[model samples]
Target chain A: MTGHEERFDSVAAYALGALPPAEAAAIKEHLQTCALCREEYAYLRPAVTAVAYSAEACTDAGSGAVAVSPLLKSRIMKRVRSEAASREAARRIWPAYALAAACVAIAIVTGLTDLSLNRQNDAQRQTIADLAAPDARRHFFAGGEVVTHGGRIYIAMRNLPALPAGRVFQAWTLARGATRVAPSSTFAPGSGGVAVVALPEAATNIAAVAVSVEPYGGSSQPTTKPIAVVRI
Target chain B: MERVRLRDADAFEALYDGYHRLVYGVAMRVLADPGAAEDVTQAVFLKVWSSPALFQGGSFGAWIARVARNRAVDLARSRSSHGESQLDETLVVEEDLEDTALANIDGERVRKALARLPVEQREPIELGFFGGATQDQIARQTGLPLGTVKTRIRTGLRRLRNALEDALTV
Candidate 1:
């Protein structure tokens, strides 16, 4: 046998009090063939004997064989019986739990696709909510981008009402100098209606924020009046 | 001794019969006052019966000892609020804990002697107090290397034996 297999056999024999039984009686043993294992056992025997003997010295009632009285055993058996009953009760309700879990999974998946595209748009809504101080999530940042940070205005629109095929929506900052609107973000109806039009931060005393429906591509100038506006 | 997870008369009786001494012993060992120990023992078994799931897959003795230990510690702290001193070291806990509790059975000189060893040596001595959890459980719980845990327990035990023997004499 391999060295490891031989070594483990010796220790196992030592642990179980069987080393002498095999060497003294068993015929055709490996230890009889190997002298090294014999020599190791000679030294290991005393060490093992000393260890086995040490546990014997400890003997007070506090040290060994703690008694479990019959009364306690009866109490334990009663608890087990009642707990078994409740576990049966829980097993009976498992079908309802499975059904509830399925419903929750379905709702979670349906909510996923709308999530990614709306995440940034949602953040803009959060900014508005921050300003509005809305108590609820639905009332906050409805949706939009920073139209004015410092003295520059930028607007990003997503999922807004689209123009006829080849048409686009034009957005305006509507401040004093930005009264004359410029070509802003391009939005396709079927494709994602999302983009930012340059709306530079102009006068500090701005009027409002607005989006206007324009022609194919966009209006060379202002055409339709702003569809939605919030007076700042 | 008493059945903790269920409301059954025999279970209650058995639990009361078997563990009353352990619970009382733990409380007495930790709290020292007879009245406080008895009260803590009553409260511990009451909770044990109500929350049986807390001991799921765990040893009954370990679970009961923990409950007794916790309740006793709480009672000891409460007593301190009433102007009593903190629990003394000589409190004689039931044998189950006191047997394995090297510090409790032999006394704190062993613990103090243990504390004198390096941190690496002191930890395995503490591990012996964990009654039922395996060495691997301790390694996983403490996030220590597996070999390190084994070595510390073995090497530290040897040192503790040498030191504790001397300390016991002192």
Candidate 2:
């Protein structure tokens, strides 16, 4: 095992919810960038879970195991069904983007496109202004360079491997004093291993921004250490 | 999970029926309060329903148990009650969780290994896991130095991992 591998017994501590808040948060950030630790964690989770449950010998009602309230089950089931129905409804409808695109096409054809074009130009100018802000910070890591400006993050990278079909590189940010690494956006590299993704909202209170390989549509958490991290 | 993926109400209900106790038990074990545990349990199932895709084909029981424990700990911290000593001997036993956990891990072997643990190592582990105490809290509660508490817990986990490996070989 490598020197860093030796500290992973804390993964057990992490799984058990025994670590102090800041320490736990630090471990989580490290776990995002360490595949070896993630693998060890995956292997140890079931065992630790067994230990956690065995810590309490819950029996049936006659055996002194506390019974869950019957009302809880009904309440849970009711919420689940309601959510499932809503999801089904959502799936059957057209996504907002498609509808918005169609409306824009109609407006342009009707000669009412000036206002829409002006709004798009304003957004483009704002993006340019954000990138040009004097307080912008720039840094580089394994894959490429990152810049944060005016509450927005931009990653320009070359040398990232071409993602397989249905996979993308996800951007993540660890805000100052935050325990969880929040996901920002997703993109795939273009021709010749070049990719650029901008996260307009990733600059708030963030200490660093990173990119990780993830399944298409992105993951809420990184499964492995990032290909690159731009420390703020 | 397949049925859950399909959004089948019957399958969801069946899942709830099977795992409610384990979920509720883990929450109660940590929170030490039935009302809070019940709320956590309900919230957990609701999360499962909303994001069935999060399972990623792992052991369903372990996933739910992990969520239950984390949520319970969060609730305990929010209530500022984690520091209050709440250890109960009846709840914490020498038995292994494998005995009843859905993962079917080897309980007897784990029990034997836990029984063999040095008291110095075992005490901190128990205080941390069963009592929901951090290393600093364990140190304060046991009057052991912080470094000593950290050493004992890490050593205990290392030993437990070794014992588990031995059991797998057997």
Judging by DockQ against the true structure, name the best candidate: 2
Q: lDDT of model 2 at residue A92?
A: 35
Best by lDDT: 2
Residue-level lDDT for A99 in candidate 2? 24
Assess each model's interface with DockQ, reporting 2 decimals per model: 0.04, 0.24
Interface RMSD of 1: 16.1
Tens digit of lDDT per residue, candidate 2, span A65-138?
Answer: 56677888888888877866655553332123222232332232223346677765565455445444433444
Regions of model 1 farther than 4 Å from truth: A1-232, B1-4, B81-170
Query: In model 2, what are the clashing residue pairs, if there are any?
Result: A33-A225, A54-B97
Would you estimate the TM-scores of all the predictions? 0.26, 0.53
**Root-mean-square deviation of each candidate, in angstroms?**
23.4, 16.3
Q: What is the C-alpha local distance difference test score of candidate 1?
A: 0.43
